[model samples]
Target chain A: MNLDLRIPMGLLFTLVGLILTLYGAGTNGSPIYASSLGINANLYWGLVLLVFGGSMYILGRRGQRRMEREPQKPADTDSGAARRGH
Target chain B: MIHTELTYVDWIIMLLYFVFVLGIGFALKRFMKTSKDFFQAGRALPAWICGLAFISANLGAQEVIGMGASGAKYGLETAHFYGIGAIPAMIFVGIFMMPFYYGSKARSVPEFLRLRFDEKTRALNACSFAVMTVFSSGISMYAMARLIQALHVFDHLFLVMGWPLGWIFTFSIVLSAIIVLLYIFLGGLTSAIYNEVLQFFLIIAGFLPLVLIGLKSVGGWQGMKTAVASIDPRMLHEWKGIMHPATNPMGIDIIGLAMGLGFVLGSGYWCTDFLVIQTAMASHNMDAARKVPLIAALPKMIFPFLVILPGLLAISIATPHTTTTVSMQGGAIIHETNIVPPEVEQGRGLVPAKVNPVTGKPMLDASGKPLLDYDMATPNMLLHFFPTGILGLGLTALLASFMSGMAGNVTAFNTVFTYDLYQSYIHKNASDKHYLAVGRWATVGGILLSICTAYAAINFNNIMDTLQLVFSFVNAPLFATFLLGMFWKRTTGDGAFIGLISGTLAAVLHHGLSLPLEAHPGIHGGWIHVLHTYPSDMAQNFYTAIWAFSANLIITILVSLMGKPKPEAELVGLVHSLTPKPDTGHATWWRRPEALAVLLVVLLVVLNIFFF
Candidate 1:
């Protein structure tokens, strides 16, 4: 799977799982509360953070990989080394 | 006359516990080969030990005593302080913050500031945190001493001391402080971690029995439920009664306060405080550091049930009629109006006239009238319930908690002093040996300062209240600067420094000025009631955190824009560094969208069911 798609998918599943756990724990009410809200508040917020976090993680990794694959400027290397020391 | 005395078994248990603790410190001394070893445990602590130490360091006399008191007063809602107030922040620190810190190999939080910003910001933070550590340590010591005296374990030591040991209070404080100091000074962070692991187990063992026995005594879960129901239905509801203006002093909106506390206080403490971070930083690798919080999170979730539930149970078992009145040592009652309910009141003078039909103990009021002081509720429960040997074990467990917390604070102070202050400023070219020596001296100084602060903490009615207030006034300001410095490249050292100082000043001034208005309004005023009335419980903390954070963000942004921007290279490097590498594996469950989504769901559900 493409890294971007894979990361977001993984995050989606995790968010769903989190929502389920929260619902079970009584953060969201049993089925009754969900009906009142006309939407699952637990599942909704849970999925948001999950998907966002996962997408960010994946995007962040892809950017880093792209940077690494590109030719390194000598100046970049020296400055990177110096910065790392500090 | 009836004589109450500690048995041989009690003495033996106490002796063994002391020796075992001391032995752990001494044994780990050989590991103190370098300054790093002493301060950061050679950066080799395992994830589990770090996690255990983190929990133990936090579970001191202040938490045990204050949480118990809160449990007696607030019921299940007190768990929010432990669960929401503590856990999420810890998870954030473990998942996001620690990886950055450990991967970079920064020795202390202030040192991280020095790298990210400048020396002035580092120094400012170090000084503030140092003052805070000393005060916190002192409070821990004082609580330990008070608990010891209350237990009356030293009544038999008169012969050893001579002169009827009139100085037991001073003696107990000094003795406990010295023992804790000796181990920490000898083994540094390594000993602290090792001792904390043991103490963590001991505290659990000590409290578990109380919960079990208390549950049984109250006639199992049904009985407990019925007893509590008979007293107050709010006792079972975790989130009800939390919003009442009378209970909370600062007139804080509970939802806002809970969120602010969870995000700001949690992030600041778990991420920024060296006392907690030192444990994770001591891990063998970044993975270990990251894992520490996850490993620790389980216990963190479970402990409130063990510690706080018993206090609630104590409330259930204590009868309104059984409450005794408090009197001054001079045998004079101070006042009648101070009367409190008997079941909740602890020491003399706060309850209506009453005599304990069982013990024949006179319950006296401040004016020799019978009154109950609910503060004594937990202690009275302990005295009534536990057998002699178990009581000694419980007392030792309490002491273990104090020692563990004291050791963590002392070690952190010493580390910051040795690394940031002493090595950096005092003796820039000092050898490893010299640094190690200074580290020991710093530990000693930290202990002495803590002892003094502990004595002062005694005067404060509630340790947790004082601690929360201190965090609001001090640490909340630092959070803005640290977070912005990490994420926002535009934040200059000048901006960070100015924001921190201004935010702190605002919080302190607000707290101090608000006190008088809260105590007595000059006029029969309606506006005063709306504007000036603060929620009595944690409103100060909520208000301080909000205002302090706002002040910090505003000052930082305003000052930074006016100042020259950081070099593009530096800014780019910082931003780039924050971007997680694919191979680091540090960006796992925590950063996973699914996990956070699930967590939020859980959080919302818990809030809806338990809170709303």
Candidate 2:
């Protein structure tokens, strides 16, 4: 539960985004983008993904830092009240 | 259709996705120590995570492809699947039913039934649900593998490796099944939930671009509307022709749509089905659990755009033209043609007719017109617009969807089988550690069974349709039993069990007697006798649900009145009237489940009117 899901999500997107951005740059004017109507969709969408992924990574790191700085609270007080076993 | 190509960059992108998914499973491995952890994520997930997983678990390949197919066939009317069919039931469950589920602290939906009803009812539900989930997962596997083969996604790679072209189906199926099996086995429900959230975002990433580029190609919404209007102006509006069964593309009137889909089948699936509810049940507390469905409802409603718009785009865009090039591969002449959907007629647009595999001819309907294979709408759109790099991403998204969907069913199956069937019936008083091991084995067994079913599906295509029909029959009357049991504390186990059996029988009987027009006298109904002929299959399905639900409700009420009810003391948390209201804890008024439900309802109404 301590592991922030966004950290992994952010890493995956950032890596894919980087790859896409570089590929788009290398193939900018190539005919490979013709199906995408001559627009470097990979470049633009990759940048968009990069920004989103970067923010998620930053936010996740911040959340993790905050959790570490604060004393770890019990996961939930109400969990004890809820039934546990079948 | 010409096979789309993938470059090294595309391969890298796809490989990165696989690495990340498996990495998360490994990262979460140590945490999954207990049976609770394995089956229910230790009941520790936060609302947003659970919320996304809640929707994503249901957002399998069938949803992505099926909705797109429906969008092409029914146009904006397809929004009814969310607007009227799904959203209300989701809101209803969150607001009215979550307390009973989360409050009673049942491990699975069947367990919940056992607490509120009896052992017999639980056994009936658990067995049916177990069978249903495995088959559904298998169906997803089959669909994904076939789609890969149809798209020729790995054909070039297979050829390069000196593998037969037919092996792609087996390779894709086995590979995806193993991937799903490994993750779930490693991290249990937590991995599935985490991967589902990732898959949710990836689906958006993949399809959102398709919609944008497609709209831009066709000059945005206005241009797309104009293009669709030329096909059928009614297709542009969601409710224009919905007053009569024969008029609308869906061939269902408001009553059938509201009662059958919205009230019966929708609630039955969203509220009672363990696959989705299990995600909500994994939340940390009652408040978070309540918020899960409400949170999911927002994205769930908006998904029409992400999924269905591509279908509209597929049909609206200019007809695809194929250019063939002949080349020599291993001294054999290879004719490569660009595989895009072509318009057979003016209104048909890019939708292609269903072709007979053996005869290599278009399949004709009872009306003599060719049957349109609307399932191609989304795949063709992905292939048409995306270049190699993004195409790989798009296909990965599709594969991710299939895997997550399979994982959802597998997790749900393992839980039900472990807790309800194995622990309760097969062997009682087993150690917690013993059950955890059983759960892991169940996960493996479920995937293997799913693989067998997937292969079975490949050989017998009607098996999917037949299983779906059987599930609907078993599922349609379910909400009524739950509704009475939760609200009316007087309902007894005998009443529920008999009511459920009778309801399923009613559904079978109804389906057998009623026939959809332009269909044969078998799976399409009317096997017993053609007493009523529906205008469309959708109408037939809705009415079947309505009949089954009505019969169950009436019979359940009648039967319950004749039986002795459980004592009030025993029914406290299990009954709606007896249980106290759930506290919102530190949540703001705006963030409360009821408030969110209200907001979702308003949004649903606005969407209906906007599209109307």
Candidate 3:
């Protein structure tokens, strides 16, 4: 599969989300959240990012599978027309 | 007041963040097999990626630090930069100018100048841009270093080593520069782009919570507004005192906002400047290129709330009551002092509050006010809101934002040096491999130059002032040359060249010859030939842009009319009237550039009306 951004971004987000989530859940009801007005921002935002990142990973995986099945094509480098790799 | 509350957990988070950033750079190193991957990200980036990257490229210290600084100092006037100054110009670029950039097959903005104008014009822009990028990179580096010092991020280590504060500051800057250099040197633009996207997320994750907590602490927006109203009623509205330039905090009203900032500075930056444009130019197709800035505008419009709200909230907690002197006009406190206080090195508004001799703590004023350093708005907000690990993440996010800005400029500089200056002048028939090698060398050279400029940033009192000075010198007149050349087929190369040079001279002369107003905030360091100062540095900037742009427009039109025009056949795709529009086939409402442009423009109008 190509180096699609969704895959990497998803992976990174999921990793960070998991870390934040686990730490936050373990440290739930701590006095620290008092500074943030009693909101467990880490746990909440981590779950949000986890769901977002997971969906992105799924979508990227589907795209990668489709690309693998399809025939490869060369970039449109036709002269007189602007194309990639300029 | 909130104190620096970093802990072991925060250190772990930061360490992990660094690992992720460097790991991505090293992982993407293989993509650097060709210059295409390094410089242009192989021109295969999706619109959303490039769009985020475009804003993130500029999401540097200037955006966060300077805007927050401005928010604290000027209150709602800072929004004018986003609404009037940025949105209109960005729309103009997306709907009108993207064709010449994406469709004309130009590698860089300077290259586009060469295509449309003469060799001299391109060289002029290329040289100025290269120098500007380095200087800007240095400013971001300096800001990050300064923030680190002000926030006392490495105080524990510094205290342990018994290091002098200056040495610690320098070390912070060098450390930032080295990290940015590593990433850019490894994966080049793709790494920068990917990191920028990450930085965007990190910034939101870091700051959004801070804003929410800040608002909650301050008793919500209305409560904060009422509190700020007691300090200065003018702080609550965007267009307050805009009719009178002197009395207003920004020092210019409708004319300066509309003509100077919106027209000259706005068009000059958003249209002619190549830093952000380079990101948009990396889109997968012309349609994507057109959408890049448009999509970025969606976020750009909302960004003021993210960065500026922190500054507005700062006034509620640490009131600008002492040290940072301001004049009361129309019940708003317009800043009287622009330089950093002698007692503080962090530049621009860190005034000391009087203390109670009995307890030796900060003494309250007659109105029972806290002493404030306006420049410390965003930093203090972070210090106040988060605890331990979360604080570390926020600091890392701030650090990431600053580095992304530096990387953006460095990457842009290397490409311009490679494609525009080196290929066109130094070495003509070089292989792709040879050029790639030069690009890497240029990257190193750019970082070195930026480090030198970062040291120079120490002499300046404010980052925003220095940036405005650079804009006045280079970008102000650029849009005139661009507008005339691209639209008017009659514009000649010689005419364009003469107009550009003379216009730049006009900007310099206007600033130098004008009488210095007492309210002018910035002290001229390098260009100290000032006859007089304006009431404010902001006022001087707007007037300079106006004069320079007018001179450029008039001169270019006259010269073009006098000179022989390039043949229409030769100017087909370059000029608007002569060239046929491309059938981009992006017919869907959201995908179409015009649809987005129109929607954004409507939003801008609604915003202005509301603000008015």
List model 3 lDDT by residue over B1-612, tens digit each.
Answer: 223345555777677777777887888888788888788888877788888998898888778977887888778878999998888888888878887787777889999888888799899889989988888888788778878887889886677789876687789888888888888898888888888988888888778878887888779988778867776777777877888876677777678778999999988888877889988888777777878888889888878889998887876664222332223346453444344323232222222343444775665535656544566768767766675557777888898898999999999999999999999999999888898889989999999988887777677557546574755677788889989988889999988888988889898788766644543323442154656556666776788889899999999999988989888887766888876675555365565788788899888877767655
Which candidate number has the best TM-score?
2
Clash totals in order? 50, 3, 8
Could you give the candidate ranking by lDDT, starting with the highest? Answer: 2, 3, 1
Docking class of 3: acceptable
Q: For candidate 1, report its TM-score.
A: 0.75
Please give, for residues B482-527, the per-residue lDDT of candidate 1 as tens digits: 7788677788999999999899887766565543223443221221
DockQ of each: 0.02, 0.38, 0.29
RMSD of each: 14.4, 3.3, 7.5
* TM-scores for the candidates: 0.75, 0.95, 0.88
Q: Which residue pairs collide, candidate 3? A: B515-B532, B515-B533, B516-B532, B516-B533, B517-B533, B517-B534, B519-B535, B520-B535
Which candidate number has the best lDDT?
A: 2
lDDT of 2 by residue, B431-518 (tens): 9999999999999999999999998987886999999999999999999999999999999999999999989999999999999987
TM-score (chain B only), all candidates: 0.84, 0.96, 0.88
Off by over 4 Å in 2: A70-86, B1-4, B324-347, B366-368
Question: Candidate 2: lDDT of B187?
Answer: 93
